[model samples]
Target: MNIILAIILLVILPYVGFWKLFEKAGRPGWEGIVPLYNAYVMIKLCGRPTWWFILVLIPGLNILVFIGILVDFVKSYGKFSLLDHILAVALPFIYLPKWGFDKNTKYIGASATAPFREKYKIALKKTATREWADAIIFAVIAATLIRTLFIEAYVIPSASMESSLLIGDYLFVSKVNYGARLPMTPVAFPFAHHTMPLIGTKAYWDGVELPYYRLPGLSDIKKGDVVVFNYPMDADSPLYRPVDKRENYIKRCQGTPGDTLSVVDAQVFINGKAAPTPPHGEMSYTVQSDGSEINPQLINDLHLEDLAPGINNTFTVNTTLASVNALKGYSNIKSIVPTLSPKGMEDPLYPVYPVKFPNYKITPNFPKFTWNLDNYGPIIVPKKGWTVKLDSLTFPVYGRAIEIYEGNKVQVQGTDILINGKKADSYTFKMNYYFMMGDNRHNSEDSRFWGFVPEDHIVGKALFIWMSMDDNASFLNKIRWSRLFNIIH
Candidate 1:
């Protein structure tokens, strides 16, 4: 389910009531069923040059061209009400047929012609209602374009990037920072993402998908950029979606394309060099107290995940290093140490992805990996044109990416690998890939669990926090006033 030439959807809509419309216009009704010819006939019926329909293929001009043709066609049939024009695009199947089949609705002439417009100028005069409607429509379109091509507002929905990006933090993401990805699912409802509100149906139609394309960016996605991207796994939802319509996920890019990334004892390393950890990044730690019940207020004040009771006044909690150091000064706190899963140790609470295989025999036929959340790969991020040999070891690491993300049919049979029905020893990546991980290391479901995020899944770079709210706080203290307009690191 990808692109369909784009024009077929907004312009031709041939399978709709175009046949009846064409017949009423003194043109062969069958012409309405043809592809490009139908669109040409539409422009011709609107008294527009047939060649003007070519603008329908042009990205920026397409919407204008469609609107013009729609307005002209409707006006030709004496349908001039604002509601009529709105439904002409919003519910074209119903409106087009209603207009086409109605005996009273007759084509006056080419309503877009200069002579017709001059004659109807007084009739087209805007009422106060029409003036407001036009202004609001223009505003909606302008805002939509700005949000699509420049920046968009996003709210942090989870504590995955807590301490850095808190839940309820509203931020502006800059599409220009890493290039604005053109909509792959183009025919979606305004302001609605994948799902319609209340009714819970799909908000988009897959009939008008566009191929992945990006405008030139100010810079490439670099390490440490907080990025909002389409969830590569399609995320928590069971229902699948087109790439751009997939759930938006926010995470720090731990590794960019072509970088070899690894997590050693909870610290990230890129190309054998230790990368700087987020200033307020949190991880699970074992905290032993001096046989005193630690203050519950301290836990809430520090924003620790929770203090799970254990023997000997010890507890496991997730909090930032700064908070851990603050607790060290308290007499009741015995020791605070980060909880790490030793090289061969796997934590039930922090299960790593199967790509980091653990139990397989290390033979030519099988591979073994004991990687865990706290200790992960030296896996290479796939760059465009980068090819890697596929085998037992690499299959688990990159197979899903090669097959699903890159679109291929893969099969394995007794030591032989088949891609697209042919034997393939290697695969060259069609797009660059990224490795994303959240600030809350142990508690985050991230690239460590899934795998690489394809370039097409990128949305934008989070620019700054515009507003922040504390949902658990009292009404008077709800606003996180200090964080407003703070630039995202």
Candidate 2:
């Protein structure tokens, strides 16, 4: 409904403003009020090929297409100045109608036609200022189109995806893999994502958000694929932003829609089976030594993330199995075991800034379930058309998803669940959801910490690492040349 209103008010009104202008161009005035037909007539007036109209159908590309057509349509009336084109796009409801009413604004000829170019083309050389301005505008538009509709470059800023995707690794996330999601927050500053750099203000307007929509994609997100998605937590609260404008996070898809998933001592089981683990994945381990401090150099060699010395000469470390095996070989090492949280123990860091979760916690929010970080639910991931009984247990697990991400008004009173103001015992999911976990399990702030990632929040599949830089390495050794173009697992 908002999209239709936006089209009627912002889009169709411009064509309505161009009614007289279209009639002057030898087309019927009624054609201007007709949406797609108006664009067709405008293309004819501007002498652009009929195929150029396809741009109007593409979601991300249409913004550029609309502006370009406006510029071309205005130029057909001998309005060639940059200001004229700018107003034609920026204030089309005002300037388009102004031109439509101005008798002096003549339908000179098709804007870019050979005959029109021969007659009205100025012999004066374009000023250096104009050339630079034109170049910058063209570059911005071209880059925006490419970034939106095709592959985009992403840099790993944290060790959440360490090993499989290291910090400082520049990856090419393929939009086409799981389809390019249309911009929900369309009125955003170009290149600036959710926030304006330096100023620390929002870069997008949420007043006119479009619905969650996606173009056709090569494949669906499946298990083991390293995927990039909008951080689902940003859907509400003090950090709320449009889904597309949410912070980008990359993780390995461990559980897909419809699959029941559980974590037992940090090992994920999907649908009653042990899921395939990433070769580079790491997890927390408690390393006990025979009251001896191991060599500091050996600690660095293991590439352990956390190496906090515990009481009784034990060390709580986070590292891959390879590191654990290497540590096992040491003479002073007594034992190394996974630091699993015993069943029902709440994570000490829960419901806080460092550990960002929903408004409520486990027991009070939902039914009493003794689930913790290392040992969690055998919860079913929601799939489209899947219906669940909306009670205390299910509501807490899926309430945020039901009311917030899926766009519904969910209210709980006594023992009754009300969705969209209607008392309902069950709710059908509108979209599929996935479980994402970082390869660096203990260190990663991922789906395990938050919840399931909605299908709409999915961005793209990580294709490969184009560049990798090691910040800790010396200048000469900084370039991780061997990892370049390595296909993401």
* CA lDDT for candidate 1: 0.82
Task: State candidate 1's TM-score.
Answer: 0.80
Model 2 weakest 10-residue run by lDDT? 348-357
**Candidate 1 collision pairs:** none
The Cα local distance difference test for each model comes to: 0.82, 0.82
The positional error of residue 432 in candidate 2, measured at the CA in angstroms, is 1.7
lDDT at residue 481 of model 1 (Cα atoms): 99
TM-scores, each model vs. reference: 0.80, 0.90
Stretches off by above 4 angstroms in model 2 are 1-5, 33-40, 49-69, 90-94, 123-125, 291-293, 348-366
Tell me the alpha-carbon RMSD of every candidate.
5.6, 3.0
In model 1, which regions exceed 4 Å deviation?
Answer: 1-118, 235-237, 295-297, 347-365
Error of 2 at 332 (Å): 3.2
Give the backbone clash total of model 1.
0
